[model samples]
Structure formats: structure tokens, C-alpha cells
Target: MILLQANQVARHFGGETLFQHINLEIKDKSRIALIGRNGAGKSTLLKMLAGEEEPDEGTITRTKNLSFGYLAQHTGLTSQKTVWEEVVSVFESVHAIESQMRELEKLISLESEKGNHADSNNYLEQYAALQQTFLDSNGYGIESEIKSVLHGFRFFESFYDQPVNTLSGGQKTRLALAKLLLEKPDLLILDEPTNHLDIDTLNWLEDYLQGYRGAILIVSHDRYFLDKIVTEVYELSRHQIYHYTGNYSRYLELKAAQQEQEWKAYDKQQAEIAKLEDFIARNLVRASTTKRAQSRRKKLEKMTRLDKPAGDEKSAKFLFQAERQSGRDVLAIEQAAIGYDDTVLSEPVTLHLRKQEAVALIGPNGIGKSTLLKSVTGQIPFLKGAAKLGQNVDIGYYDQEQANLTSRNTVLEELWQEHPTFPEKDIRTVLGAFLFSGEDVKKTIPLLSGGEKARVALAKLSMQKDNLLLLDEPTNHLDLDSKEVLEEALIDYDGTLLFVSHDRYFINRIATSVLELSENGSKLYHGDYDYYLEKKKEEQEVAEMTASKTEAEIPAASSAKRDFQQDKEHQRQKRSLEREIAALEEQLTNIDTHIAELQKQMEQPENLEDHEALTELNNQLTAQMEEQDAVMAEWEEKSLLYEDTY
Candidate 1:
């Protein structure tokens, strides 16, 4: 069934047409993605479709009483209720039915206590009917369902009691999305849903949305995320919507072919026009061919000329280069500890990056991945060992926050100020290469959006010509096209790289090695993100297999003459596993109770205004989750080994 439709939709800004002749249709269980470059008016059109704004022309229609949920980018939930209350508020109908069921229970009990079987039977039937309604509405497993979703968003059970108002902006955005999911509307409209999510959470969300019951219309720049969830793509470009019947990658393929065909048809018509014009010009003045010339002129006048084919939006153009090559062993870090003040987030992290190598730094949130990069750049003091640069290594840093930028300076002046000796034309040329032309160059840094600021930072980075670059979350605010351009620049860059990024697609294209950080240290996997995951899974399997190796300790143990030494070793291994299992069980029990305590606190209405308390609680919860993963892994390993011994 068609859930919504927009007919001849047109939108205008001021007096100019932003987009016109736009037609859209959304059906039940549709998975559509809206994609375009920045400033293509994708968000504006989404607002129109979502009924948050009305089109200046045309009309939008929806099914009667059609339900939908709209989640704008970076829009966080603001509520005084605890997380549990806020999410559970979606089930008010279920709650109302529960009240009815409870009242029925009271009447049934009253009659039963009086030994009046006839009256009790009527109340019992009402109770049974109400209970079935509750079950059908998913009232019974609410807590477990909440737990699964909360865990997927990294909320865990503890944060269930945390007031929705007290969460960090990112956390609140996640909660807003969580509440929307619980509502289970017939249509879901999400803009940039992947903004604040990590790889794990992104993975979880991809899985969740794949199984989502309602139709989804999303606007996001994460190509990987789009590829996984969306079945159709709508590209808003050149004041129009172009629909393609596939995912993002497939859309690219079809778009290229379509563009090629358009250009070809236009070129063919232009050639025919040129021939006709030449004939008319040459023969119009000649007496012998006057009739033929007039006929050609009439035909030319009647021809409906094809308009020139438009191309994609203007894209930034720049390349990263190195002035000089660094010596072998571009950078080396041994036993380095990085953190702020007294906190040692991670220690004994080692990396030996050779010349022209690209490495991706990855870790959980708050594990000090950024701190490690900063320590190398001398922005922070190392808590333990130092990062020694190899001979002639020059570092260029791209901070995600763009802090090093001259915010007060205009885009033109920001580049000009950096290289004052260069000519104005030369500076403008470079700025223009980054799509900051004309008056755009005069805009101050503070006025530029996140994507524009990112371009400015990248423009400066491209100019530095440094032999080594340390980038932190380099793809944070970039659109898909800009990210691809940057990826191309970095791929051809004649430098070494050690950058922190959560963009798995970017990492997959750029990284020669993956460095995973932990509290104790960092480990290097000699591959891309996917390969790193493969190696990590293999490590787990290997750990499991190590347990089954006790039989190999003594060949005769499987048969008759097992020596005392062999028996002793087996017993010792069994005893050690037993002790480890007992400790793990205790740790697991304690962590579970801690989580329950947080949930209890979340249940309290008083936590609604306690922002600082919630922040502290979140920090503790992160540690507990990390500990829980480790403990679970260890316990599973030991338990398997213990079973093999028997």
C-alpha cells in the first residue's frame, strides 16, 4: 500500500526556486535513501515530505491517519523523565489495557473470595481477553526488548533510569532514535541517522533497520550504512530528484550509465543542428537552392532543441603531497602511555610505522585514541614513554574539531595568512580548488558549516606538504563525495599516516594496517578493517582451541600408561581453570548487580535534573561494559578447557 505521495512538489527560497517539479512516492515497507552533495536541498525536501514544512507549490497527501516518525539530524530528546519512562511512554495504550486488566483481576478476586463462582466467571473472561490484548501488544517482554535496544545503542541496563534530559548530546540523540523505534510507526523518516554512532553501534543499527517493520526514508552520507539497509536511492541534484532502483553503490553504476547516455544523445542532436545551420547559411543567398534553403530553415525553426545535459554539483579538488621523503621507520612508539592528568587510559602501546605507510588507529570511546595521536604531535605530555620520530619526519595534524583553524579569519584570509608571501591570485586559486570561490572565500570560519570548515582544514593540510600526517576522525563532517575525493588524495599522498577514524569504508580504502587500542596496550593487525576483524575472530577461535590441546601434552594419556608428570600437569590445568572460572563468575555477578543498580537509579524520577551524576554514571558504565566483554571471553575460554579435561 502507498503510505504517502507528493505530487508536483515545488519549493522556493526567497524568490528563487530551490527545487521544482519534484514528485515522490513512498510505499509500505519501502527502504529508500535520499542522497546528494551538500547544498543540494535534500534536507529541505525531507522536511517537506515529513510534513514539517509545506511546499510552496503542489501538494502532499498521505493515507488517512497514517502514522510516521521523523528524526532530524542531531535533534536530541529533551525530557525530565527517566530513560525507561520516556521509552515506555510509547506504550500508553498497552498501559491503559493493563489498568483494565488489573481492575478485572480485583473483581474476579473479590467474587472468588466470596465463593460466588457465577460472578467470578464473568470477570475471569474479561481478564483473559484483556491479557491476550496485552500479549499481542508485546506488553510482557517490554523490559527485555528495551534491554536489547538500549544495549545496541550502548545504553545498557544501567542507563534505563537515567533521565533523558541529562544525557550528552550524542546520547540524547541515540535515545530519541530509540524512542522512535519503540513507537513503531508506519513510516520512519531519518536524516543523518548514522551521525554520532560508532562502528559497533552502526553495525547494530544496520541490523535493526534491516528488520524494521515500517517503511524507511533516510538521508545519510555513510555509504556503507546505506549499502546495507536501503533498497532504493533518490538523488536530489540540479533542482530535481533522480530515482534509481538499487542501493548506493548500485545507484552510482546506474547513474554513470544514465549520464553517459544523456551526453551521447545531446551530442548527436548538436551535430545534426550544426549541419542544418551550415546548409541554411550557405544556400539561403543562392537563387538555385533558395527553395531547399527555406525548407531547411523551416525545419530548423520547428526542431525542439534538447537542453544541455547538467552534471553533478561542483566538487572540491585538491591533492595531498610531500615535499621530501622521510627516512625508513617514519615513526616509532614503544611502551607509550597516553591520558590526561592522572588517568592512564592506555599504556605500553607500540607502533613502528615505516616510510609511506598508512595506519588506522581504532578503539572504544574514551580509550584515548585521540590522546595517543596528540602525544605524538607534542600537544600533550606522554604519561610514560615518548614517541620518537625517524629522521626528517614532518608531522601534519588534522584534528576532528578543527581547533587549529583561525576561526576569526575569512576563508580567503585563513589561507592567505598562512602563506602571506604567496600572491592573492595564487591563494584564491587554491581556495577555488576546494570549492570556496567568489564570495564563499570571504565567509569567516565560524560562519561556515561543519562540512565547509572540514574543507578549509583539508585545504590547509594539502598545502603543508608534510611527510607524515596524524588525522583524528578525518571523515567526521564530510559528505560522501568529499570523502571519496579526500580518500583519493590520501591514497596518492607520498607520506606516512597514523589516523583515528570510525569510518570503516574510508579505513578499508586507505589503511595498510589497523591498530586496535586497549587499556593495557595496543596491537597491530597487518590489514584493513575487515581483515582486522577476521584476525580478531581467529584469535578468539585460537584461544578456544588452546584449551583442547591438553590431550597432546602426553600421547600415552589417551591410552594406558599415563605418567605421573602428565597426570600432575592435567590436574594443575584443571585446578587453574576452576579457580579462573570461579573468579570470572564472581566478577560477572558483580557487574550484573552494578548494572541493576544503575537501572534502579534510572527508575528514580529525581535523576531527571542530575546531569553531572549521569555523566559520571556513564563513564562507570563504559568501564563495566569493557570489563564484562573481557570477563565473558575469559570465562568462555576457561569453561571450554575445563570441559575438555573431563
Candidate 2:
């Protein structure tokens, strides 16, 4: 059931090689992830797989009529239509059927009013057929489907009529994903689909994608999301792709073990090689032992040497340090309201931060998580009660937007300006720790990529040595490795932390407590992200229980109704459709068996020598595959009917 396969896929730039000799296969319903450090050509490889970009040297094969949907990273949908129209566009065929059903309904009503029973019956037949088509195409449930997906993306019905062009960047990105999900392509290729998604929406998407019927190929830095959805991991490293079994966590475990074994084997081989070389060198000069030395030399020449194991040599590295330890009370926020001009997004926020406490601020988008952080730093004035810093507390902020980093200065100057007293080499040393070295430091700030700018901002922040850190989406543009590195640093920081992040893994690793912001106010969960989730789950269960009790006490609606003869006939039609689907499936299986047999025969030595026989076998294989495709289409239609029937 391989939906797509690529052989010897390779891509190259102007005069440099990005990756080569790559091979990949995507099976039906496969949940696959491609992960690597930034600049490792992961996005390029994804584009090639989606058929949006051709590989420089490779052949990609896909099943006939394969449908594919690709969501490039950070690319939002540029639509002039309203949100409702944009999403409904995915159901054009269903809409056509719906129109026909409406026309048939009108004709039947007109005939019945004119006292023409026979004409009405004729119209009724057409209506029934059109209705079946509409149901099979999911026209009846289209609105519900769109609403469900939009809800998962945190879009309510009130926003349905709004123009897509007016939506924020994050909202547009979510809308693009929702549209793709509704389309339900055979292969869904997502590049950083978790971007801009809060924890609640992320959880919803993870649940949806887990039950997705199609294959998925994703390039994301969300380790927690990947662990929940993907079953296979592909690592692109040092110009090659390696496949590993299981989820992201399992892949890490397996990869670490595999790398360790490779190193041990490599070391063992080197020792053996050194021993052999020494023996040959020492004994070759001795006439009495010349034959033995020559034998050893011959053996050494025949032995295959193992290539050195590739490592992550370019992973960003840095550390966070506090200049001075703060008092026991690091920060205090009481009855604080934060928002833009004349708009109160959240109110009555109250919190107490102790020294060396890491707190994560989480909420749905537009709830002022980032604005709250800004208010704390005095960048944006609080609408109500202001935050009060503890005795001798100093603050450093990491803006997710990198607003303070808009400069024409070189990367070196960006950091060096903050501490003019430090020597040039000393400034470069700190930059080098963050993988900005040599010519990289001379590059202008505007030319740096999102990831590069993030590192530079961090480099500057780390040097400030503030005891209180306020970060907003610190893992926004980081690759998986860099995010882990930052997480490790923040986890070990001696100062107190209050950051806003959508990265669940990052929050779990760093946050000692969770502060959940809402439109009404803020509530503190005195535990890590996981503990917060557990409490939320318990609350949801209680709410559901209360709802169930209320529902039970209310009067029951009348029992459902269906026309007796019509219902019996519908059941019969459903059974017939199931039988047809089963038959088509069996036919496809038989065709596949024949195709396999033909391929095996073509590989036989006698068939290979006989060109005529080989050609015949190849022709037969192609014919069988064509037949399978036709049968598969029929089976799909029948299955759809079975699922959609009344």
C-alpha cells in the first residue's frame, strides 16, 4: 500500500550539494516525520516529496489519481474570499450534487401541487438518486465538518463571514490548515503545522491527526506533538537520510543506542587496523617473516573501513546566567489587566513568583499572553494594577517577534554595543558559543534568518545577566536541537522565569508552575504543564457529568422517524453497496497477486535472457496494475456510500 516512493532522490544548489542518494517511501495511512537541524534541507526534501518541486536526480512514483496537500512553513493562505467561502471551496463536487438535489426537490413539489402523481413519481426517482450522491459525497454533513474543524482551530461561527485577508498571520495559518484538513487529501504534507497553535488547539489537532485516514508527512520542531502522532522517524544528517522505527521519543532512544554502537564498532575496527599496520611495518623489513607480513598487508588491503559516524557539529550552544542572586520574592503581579488601547483582553491577574521559579503562561490566542509579558517589562503599560518587582530584581525579556532586534548593525555590533567595554575577541567568543563565528558575526542583522536572529537575541540576553527573565515564545523559530539546548539552559538557570510559549515539551521541561490566562482573569496551577493538563481533564469530566445530569432531567425528545418501506429499501441498498465494495476489494487483491507473479517471472534467468518473454511479462504486469486502479476507484465509491447511507 505504498502511496508514493522516491528512489535516489537528490537536490543541489548552484554549486553546492545539500543532500544526495536519498531514498524514501510513504505507505497508505503512514504517519511519518522528517527532522533535522536548521539548514539541513528538510523543507526542500518535503517539497520534492509533495511533487511541488522536482528532485535534481531521482524518480518519484505515485499511485494514479493520488491527491496531495502541502502546507509550507510560515506560508499563509492569500485569499480574497471570506473565511466561510474559502473553506467551502474544498466541497465543490458535493455542492454540485446538492444543487441537483435542490432542483429535483422543486420539480417534485411542483408536480405534486399540479395533481400529477406520475410526474411527481418520476421527479421523486431523480431526487432519490441525487440525494444518494449528495450523501455519499458528504454534502449533508459538510457544514458540520467545516464547523468541527474550525472549532478545533479556535475559530467560532461569528468569525465565519470575516474576510480572510483581514485575519492575523497566525489566524491565517490556522485557516489554511483547517481548509487542508477538510480537503482530506490522500497525502498531507505539513511543514511546521504546529506554528501559532496554542496548547488547547494543539491538543485538538493532535487528536484529529491521530485518527486521520490519509498518510501524513510532517516537518516540525514540536517534539511532543510528533511523539503523539508520528509512528516513524526519518533523520536527515550530513547529506544523507536515515530511517528509524517508532515515535520521536523512541527514535531518540534508538538513535542514541545506534550511534553509541557505531562509535564502538568504529573504535574496534580502528584498533584492529592499527595493530595490522604496525605488524606489517615491523615484520616486512625482516626477511625471515616477509611472507607473513605480506599476507597481513593483503588482508588489510581487502578489509573495508567504516566511515566515521556523523554528529551534530553545528548545533547551537549557549548558557543563561544571572549577574546577581535576587531576594526570595522575585516578582509580584496583583490585579493586573493587560491589553491594547481601550481593549481589555484579560483582567484581575494575580501571581507571586519566588526566586528561581520557572512559570509558563498559557491561554488561547488573543487572551493577551504576550501582552501580559510586555506589560510586565513596561514596554506596554498595564491597563490596571501593575506588576511590582521584588527587592533588587532586574528583568530581561525575549520577544518572540524580535522587535528590539530591528537594526542595520552587524551581528557582532548587535551584542558588542550592549557591552562596549568588552574587547572584540571577547564579544566574538560569546557569539561563537551560539554558533555565530568567523564571517557569521559580520553579517547584518536584517540578513539573518529567523533562527539566526533568535540565537543573536539569546546571545544578547544571556550577557545581560538579569535575575528575572520574561520570554515570549522562545522556541518559535528554533529547530528541535536548538529548542532542546535552550530548554536545557533555561531549566538550569538560577533566576526566576515567566515565559509565554506554545511548546508543550518546552513548558513541561522548564515550568515549575503554570499560570493560565483567560478573558475573565488568571488562575494559577501550582504544578508543571502535565499536572495542569491533569487538573483540566478532571474539570472537563466534572462538567460533562453535570451536563449529563441536566440532560437526564430534561424531557426526552420524540423518537426518531423514517418511512417504513423507504427505510427497508435504504438498508437493502446499503447491503448491496457493501457487497460491491467487498467484491471490488477482492478483485484488486487478485490483480495484485497476478502482478507480483509477473514481476517474479520477469526476474527469472530464462525470462531475462528471452526478450520476448520478459516484454510480455512486463506488459501483463502493467495491465494488472491498471485493472487494480480501476477496481480500487469503484471500491472507494462503494465504501463511501456505505458510510454515508441513512
lDDT of each: 0.88, 0.89
- Regions of model 1 farther than 4 Å from truth: 284-295, 540-646
Q: Per-residue lDDT of 30-121 in model 2, one digit per residue for the tens?
A: 99999998999999999888888999998889999999999998888889999999999999988888888888888889989999999999
Residues 1-646, candidate 1, lDDT per residue (tens digit)?
9999989899888988888888888999999999888878888988988999999999999999999999998799999999988888888999899999989888998999999999999889888888999999999888788778888888977888888888999999988998899889999999998887777789899999999999999999888889899999988888888899999989999999999999999999999999999999999999999899999989989999988989767888868998755654578899888899979999889998877779999987778999999999999999999999976689999999999898789999988888999999998899888898899999999999999999999899888899999999998888889999999989999789999988888999999999999898999887799999898899999778766668664464445686779999999999998998898878876876676576557556666468887777767777876776677678767866797896
Candidate 1 residue 385 Cα shift, in angstroms, is 1.9
> What's the CA error at residue 398 for candidate 2, in Å?
0.6
Report per-prediction Cα RMSD to one decimal: 16.9, 25.8
Off by over 4 Å in 2: 108-126, 544-646
Instruction: Tell me the TM-score of each prediction against the true structure.
Output: 0.82, 0.82
Tell me the lDDT of model 1 at 69: 95
